[model samples]
Target: MLRIGSGAGFSGDRLEPAVELAEKGKLDYLVLECLAERTIALAQKRKKSDAAMGYDPLLEKRIRSLLPVLKQNNVRLITNMGAANPLGGAKKIIEIADELGLHVKVAAVTGDDVLPYILKKCDSLEFKPRLSENVSILSANAYMGASTIVPAIETGADVIITGRVADPSLFLAPMIHHFGWSTSDYELMGKGTVIGHLLECGGQLTGGFFADPGKKDVGGLAHLGFPLAEVQPDGSALLTKLPGTGGALTLRTVKEQLLYEVMDPSSYITPDVIADFTTVSLREDGNDRIVVTGGSGKERPSELKVSIGYDAGFLGEGEITYAGENAVGRAELAGAVIQERLQDCYEELTVDYIGITSAHRGSFSYEGIPYEVRLRVAGKTYEREKAKRIGEEVEALYTNGPAGGGGARKYLNEVIGIVSAMVPMDIVEAELQVMEVKPNGA
Candidate 1:
């Protein structure tokens, strides 16, 4: 039986917490997923000169803290925290292991950086690019399937490092490698992959954001529970938490997690197969252990969906409240005034009243009327100066409009600007490249 634990790792602190949980849980495999296209871009900026291996130095520091525990428990781990450079990450891991006198094999999965291959393939196929005006002829990486990770496992690597494999595939690879499960066994491997999905978010399954709404003052949520998976040969898996851990595992908790990111209730696609979520069943087996049974799989799609984020322009929003007779009507007029003021400076500014009960008042309002109203104004601009200017205008309207009679007040405004990209579907398969290091003779 193989038990896999997973954690999301965009930041060092986010994933570092998992090490303690893994050690305490006595898990067989721990997987950390940390790549989104934006994550790659951030890694790129940090390592601008090298253009390949610049990851958050916090990752190295975090890993160094876990090395002793990992060696002590003989617990193997896999992580895509390598960012854009697997070898660079691997070199660091090996050096740390050597210094600590831990004899662990580290394998770097390469060729998974198929940004070049994807761009070349786009020339042959008329891929409909839906994201940006700039032609993304480069750096479009597909969320590669678990197959590429097998070579890293075969290399006797105690720890496998990767780049852009799908988040769930990080956990699935270890199961496939350990069980010698074939890719053709879609039903089985799909089950294992789904197991990874359950654990990916760390505390979601463990009553973090969700719990029985009726249950008050629950036990020991200060530490919370981590996801645990029980796997067998047939690919049927049971989900649970560590023994004596703090959380509940009713059918509702498990089902809530299963549907977390699912866009369609029926067709949930992964690189390996189209998982049919509608057919999934859950049963309570024991304390904190839920049996996930049923649900078969179909063949995977021809293309992969890549998530890319790039440079968008800039945006800001501010809010104010008004309380008095005809508050709702007065708030609408104030909003219109704010929009007209913003139009003078920004061509694309917009405003809306968000929280007032009367925003939805006309729909069915034979009932009691609202005593007060809240209004919000939002603006988007290509230039930061214009965005700030529009923000000041909206706040000025609060104390100077018809609603100004209601003693309106304004709060601080928010502003932001960043380069974002939404990467199209592409593939980054891993190829094993090895070199024999000269031995230090005794």
Candidate 2:
């Protein structure tokens, strides 16, 4: 059985502990996914200016700590934290591994950082904006497949680094090479793809963010444990965790991960899967162990997927607390008062009394009276500098108006507005396809 661990958010520094856990548990593969909407923006900015400087410190630091364990255990990793500088990132990792006298082979799966290329392609393709759309492509990342990483593993690398790839590909890459799973084998591909989906979110199945629906104690979420998947030759996988780990690995957790983002189970497309989610079954086999099997996958669609970000515009928000016998009522009045004062300053303004609302779990539920309330105001302005200046003025209202016993004023910080525009899927498609060439030295 090949043991694997996966996670949602990955930072260079946060990856250190997870690496230790993988080594301590003697797992086969460690996968970290760090790409998010904001991450994409940061990557795009870096790529345009200094391509090499965009390397995330989190990826390098984590790999540095894990290298010794990986060298000892012969563990191979696939991570997408290589935002826009996988090659530069890989070189840094190689330097660290060499200094430690560890013979680590590091290969970077490139060609996925295609923001510049995609924009040029869009100009020639005559792509149009559909929904009052504007092309502010803040970040452009390619959602590649397992083919990119497979070549890296074949280089005998202890760890493989990659740019943005489909989340499931992280789990699928190791399974394909480990079990000699063929690409065209739809039935087995489905099996492998499903396994990746189960373990990709690390602690989701291991009781971190998600827990059993009906069970309260199931959220034993003090120190969230990472998730693991054990794969077999037939593409079936055993979903479990490190020994003595604290979390519930039941059908509920597995089902939650399975049904996640799955609009249609039958048409689930992975490079390996030709079957549907309906073809699979899961059962609680043992303590913190769930066995999953049976799935078929279909061929992937033609258009290569792209994660492109554009300008979203600017926004500003401010908050203040109100405390009194009738805090809820006072808070509402304060919200109205703040809006009235700011109406002449901003073109758009929104105010909400959070304490009495669903926010904070309705904690201040009072019988016709309450202790405290949170007043919040949010809006957008074409001038970000002006918006920030406006956010600074809100706290003054507390001392000037009926702000509930004039509780100490709380001012919100300057808010910077970022506009994210979604380009057409084709707007970010690859122009120069990635061809896997054999390593020069290996």
Candidate 3:
């Protein structure tokens, strides 16, 4: 059996839970799945501003927290913290190891960035209609798979950094490298992919995101521990978490996370293999332990999904609080005033009264009016200055329109929109490079 633990579910996950896993989970690999669909686009924008600023913002902190424990426990680490720049991320890891006076081998998998290829073959690629001829593309990256990571693992690297890849592929790569699973073994690949998906979210499988107050109560939430998977040679796994952690491990939580973000259980596609979740079965082995089995898959996809990001203009937002007897009415009036003032200034605008219609958008019924409400006005425009006016006009409403308006706040942000496309596998190649670090004084 191989034990792989999830260090993080996203870029900003808590560091303590990961530290617990490294020091106590007795893990073979600690994977930190950090990147998301929009994160890479944001990283690309930051990389444009500064050359060495594209990786996960907390990458250094995470490494600093886990390095000593990982080395002490002989646990390897894998992560998609590279974001837009894998080489830069690898170098940062090397520098951190040197500062800590620890010798470690770091590997970076690159070549996922396909912006140049997209530009050269823009008219030829199969993309969504939103990516029209006029749309200005900021970044284009093809989702790579586990194949590129095999060599990195073979190089005996203590840490592996990757760019955008299928979330499950990060976990599957280690299984393949350790167990020597054949690439064509779709059933085994599917089983491994299921383990990856279950562990990818870190705490989701262990009840971090499953609490529903009194209906579905979970304990120790403040110190919730991340999850780990004890996988077998056949790709089946026993899912559990560190003892005394804050969350529960049950079939209900596992089932909920299994279906998360999945459109069709029969045909879940990825860069590595097409997993079939419908065939999977789970059994409760013991307390906080569920034995997962029966996952299957088909051949890998011929064309990889490409995430393309473009400048989607600017977003300006402003909010003002209202209280007293007729707070709802006062909030409505405030929203209307902002709408009437900026009628023709924005391409799109929205007015929502928080604590009432903002969440459900009129889906749920509210019996009584609340004592306080926040009126929020937002607008979208191509020009930053025009967007700024949306907030400025709302700020003016404190003295100009509503009687009890207070706590007014406003800001403008540049929006980076994402679009998806299909690129042939042959066009995008994955490359791996290794770097070894020596003690700074040595």
Candidate 4:
């Protein structure tokens, strides 16, 4: 059985769980699935500023913490933490290895950035009026498949980092490399995809997202363990986590994860194959173990989905807290005062009595007077300066409108909007650059 573990589910996932699995779970491969559409766009923005800053900000910390454990445990690392710059991420890894006086082989997979390709070939693109006429296209990256990573695995790399690869492909590539499964073998590919999908969102398969204090009361949440899969060559696998660790891997946890973000159960599209989740079978095998089998795939898609990010605009926000008697009234007045002040600048502004109606947005009034409340004001505009006015207005509320206003805070950022485009698979290529670091500094 080949053991694979998931270190992270998203860009900001906790790093300690991954270290736990590498040191104690006896995993053969550990995959960190970072990089979402918005995060990548943000990374691209950072890259535009510093060229080398596009990769995951946590890459260095995660690597420094896990490298020794992984090296000692003989566990290989695979991650998409490269974000927009796989090469830069690889360089950082080599530098870390050299600093630690360890021997390591690292591979950086590339060619997923399809911004230039889409611009030159496709015109009236998927997102708007016209690709050239509207929207500043910040990034365009195709979802690469397992085949892209197979070469890196073959190079005996201790750590493999990639950009814009499909989440499932990160896990599937190791299955293909170890089991010698053919990329064209749709049946095995589909089955393996199932394993990858389940473990992609690390803690979700554990108790991180499953815990409901009363309804689904789960144990060991304080230090929730990440997921791992013990696979057979035929693609059947047992999903579980490190023993004595936080969280349970029961049938409920497995089932909840099965349909998470899945639109059509039978036709889940990925870069590698068209998987059908309808045929999947799951059963509880003792405690903290779910045996998963079935779920097959047909041929891969002719076209790949590319996530295109645009400069949506700038968002400005500010908040002030009001507490004690008639706090709700004071907070409401503060919001109203800001609204009237900005009435000429905007037709409508997002002014919320946070504790009163921030979530439901004026739906379901507070039955009883709240002892404390917060007033929040926000607005979005194309111009950055206009956005600043939102926070400026909220700050003035302390002395101008609301009494007992304290702990005021404000924020502003360039909002990123994501849209999808379909590009021919032939247009994008996945390239690999492998490097080595030894104590000798070679």
For each candidate, what TM-score against the reference?
Answer: 0.77, 0.84, 0.98, 0.95
For TM-score, the strongest prediction is 3
lDDT of 3 by residue, 130-199 (tens): 5756778898998998888878898999999999999999999999999999888998989999999988
Model 3 — which ten-residue stretch has the worst lDDT? 126-135
- Candidate 1 lands at a TM-score of 0.77
Q: State each model's CA lDDT, in order.
A: 0.66, 0.66, 0.91, 0.91
Q: What digit string (tens of lDDT, one per residue) describes model 1 on residues 294-384?
A: 6666777776665433344557666677676887788888878777665667666555554443366445444666677677666665666
- lDDT by residue (263-347, candidate 2, tens digit) is 8888875433444899898878888888898887777655555555555556767677778676777777777777777778777
Clash pairs, model 4 backbone? none
Tally clashes: model 1.
12
- Model 4, 1-442: lDDT tens digits are 8999999999999989999999998999999999887888899988999987899999999999999999999999999999999999999999999999999999999999998987775565565333445768788888999999999999999999998999999999999999999999998999999999999999999978888888999997988999999999999999999888999898999999988999998988999999999999998889899999999999999999998888978999999999999888888888888888888785457888877788998778847887888888888888898898899888887788768899888889899887788888888888999999889824
Q: In model 1, what lDDT does residue 401 have?
A: 73
The reply for model 2, stretches above 4 Å from the true place, is 7-17, 47-50, 121-135, 211-214, 269-275, 344-347, 358-370, 404-442
Give lDDT: candidate 1, residue 99. Answer: 72
Q: How well does model 1 score by local distance difference test?
A: 0.66
